[model samples]
Target: MSTPARRFDTDVLVVGAGPAGLAAALHARARGLRVAVLDPRVAPIDKACGEGLMPGALAGLRGLGVTVTGQPIAGIRYLASGSCAEARFRAGPGAGVRRTDLAAALSTAAQDRGVQVHRATAGPVTQDADGVTVAGIRARYLIAADGLHSPVRRGLGLDAPVRGAPRWGLRRHFPVAPWTDLVEVHWSRHAEAYVTPVGPGQVGVAVLSGVRGSFDDHLAAFASLADRLAGVPGTPVRGAGPLRQRARRRVAGRVLLVGDAAGYVDALTGEGIAVALAGAAAAVDCLARDRPQEYEAAWTAATRRYRWLTAGLLAASRVTPVRRALVPAASALPAVFGGVVDALAGHSDGGRTTSARTRWHHLEGAR
Candidate 1:
């Protein structure tokens, strides 16, 4: 007698409830797939992040019928060693949204779309030729958007060794009026501070550093920023570590990895949300086409520029002289800097020029 076949609870099972996971659920459901999301946490989950959504990220969120309201960001400003370089978004304005607010919007949207979200932890993923099973739920495909230190990825044996210094992130909110619409990136010798205006009277400060220290210790490195935020009422500090995460591959049998689980470089470019959303879309598209193997290449194509640019910047920032000269270089070549910023914001001119322009932008940053 032949063995009995397994029954599927849903066509797609998405692990993790961050922006990437929720986006995957929404996309799969839109494609007429019975999607169910599993997460140990409840709705409105917050994390330490820059909290600035790029123009493309905002567009992606709108496409999913998720609306988030926050302060409008027109551009990015880089300040280092008494010099500054700023560039406006050629495509459109981005937004500075709180992580909790963004999560609430996505959760509501997912619920309205009829995507079933379960509050249970995923464990012991077992997949056969037919489907994948985790936590008593079986599905045709599983998406691991479980984040940088994804247990799912590790279970699937996809974790790759991360080289170089491990950088960490710390974030807190200050109850003070925003000074500018541009997201300000202040660079110090050992760390960089990202200040984003999430609301009319609230600004979020996120510090990225390779060294371990308290939030105040990291902030003290930025004299001007510390002085500006001095004596202001602030929220409790939240933190995330070793920003550079690597995965061996995005696809493994009936399972696929998305978001930070797929891989990550650094947040220096502030492209996390945009990249995660794109990855979610690509993964679902591949699954909808019944071609899970195609997801790896699709994800690579979608995020090539981001990976190259972010990795190059990280490499440069590690060197002392290059770190000191970054802002000045951008200031000296204003047009080039603007082009790079536009690429980072997901602005494309189309055709061969766009490809060539992107290469030039990447080369400039790499040098």
Candidate 2:
């Protein structure tokens, strides 16, 4: 016979233990809400990401109770079409941390806050007006932090809405020293390769492209970094599947979406973490008042802002016919190039005059 359903009560139930879920749980617990998080993966959720922490994202992390270490890259370097320029980090601070390190840190922070965490391989999420039940436990609130393909979102019938272009991610660690502190983005006609120096001894590279093929094949495009990749003694190369660039809605009923679950953009902007943390913080406020309107407003503001920025970045990536042409142009124009880098590194607001309205406009220019 099947076991009877298990029952319990909590203020909020979070699905997926990635950055978004962890941030949501931590925020909820801080606000005196009893919270629990469930994810199939145990800890250190990994994905093929650029792994550079932009300035805006850094500020968001501090607010979420996570500490980022290391010196900031002076600015971003462009290697498309053989151009090169070093722009300074526009945001107050920036860092390069592996995706695994970030996820592990967030998980520890969530546990410290007294939120219950469950690692489930797979299960069904059923909800009604009173609460939501996952696997079996009941909760007064539910959140979908389950990455790009969210089962919670599907169950809630919130699927079918997406935005922007489509791309795939492939990642790997080179067993060599990082070529430079600055993030080196090598743009090609077919694919764009991002090189981030995680530290003195290692570098992580992510190739975002429109093509569908093997990870090893994509790495060939960055043959320029071959020497650097050769020096890292223990770096391992890995890859991530296709990522949807946008999502239609971020919040529905007791169910709210955060991180890649809510929406995602090409890693070119390096704004994913910042956006998720900001959204999670907003989610806490929305949940506190139990206001659907407030949650909608918050989600719209956060994702919409990032989407606008990514569109511009993608458009600029197509300035030249040959991939080689883009790099040289980037190297030649430091100010214009740095401005884009500053925007990615979170310096778009330019401090004194930077406001949400202004930031949105700057992001639009990138498109």
Q: Which candidate is the best by lDDT?
A: 1
| Model 1: CA > 4 A from native | 1-6, 347-367
Query: What does candidate 1's lDDT look like per residue over 1-367, in tens digits?
Result: 0223236788899999999999888778666677899998978999999999998888777766678999999999999878999999988999999999999999998887688999999988999988899999989899999999999999989999999999999999999999999999999999999999999999999999999999999898899999998898789999997899999999999899999999999999999998888888889888877899999998898788899999999999999999999999999999999988898887221222223224334544665
lDDT of every predicted structure (CA atoms):
0.88, 0.69
Model 2 has how many clashing residue pairs?
26
List where candidate 2 sits over 4 angstroms from the true fold.
Answer: 1-8, 70-72, 161-165, 230-236, 316-329, 347-367
lDDT of 1: 0.88
Q: How many residue pairs clash in each candidate?
A: 0, 26
Writing each residue's lDDT as its tens digit, candidate 2 over 1-367 gives: 0112234477788888888788788777665577888877858888768888887776666655577665355557766434566777755557888888888888887777677888774377667766677767687778888887777667666776545456788787764566577877776667877778786766777888878866667766666765445444434556664576345566665677777777665666777777777777777767766674577677776566567777666766655554445566666766777676766666222221122224334444655
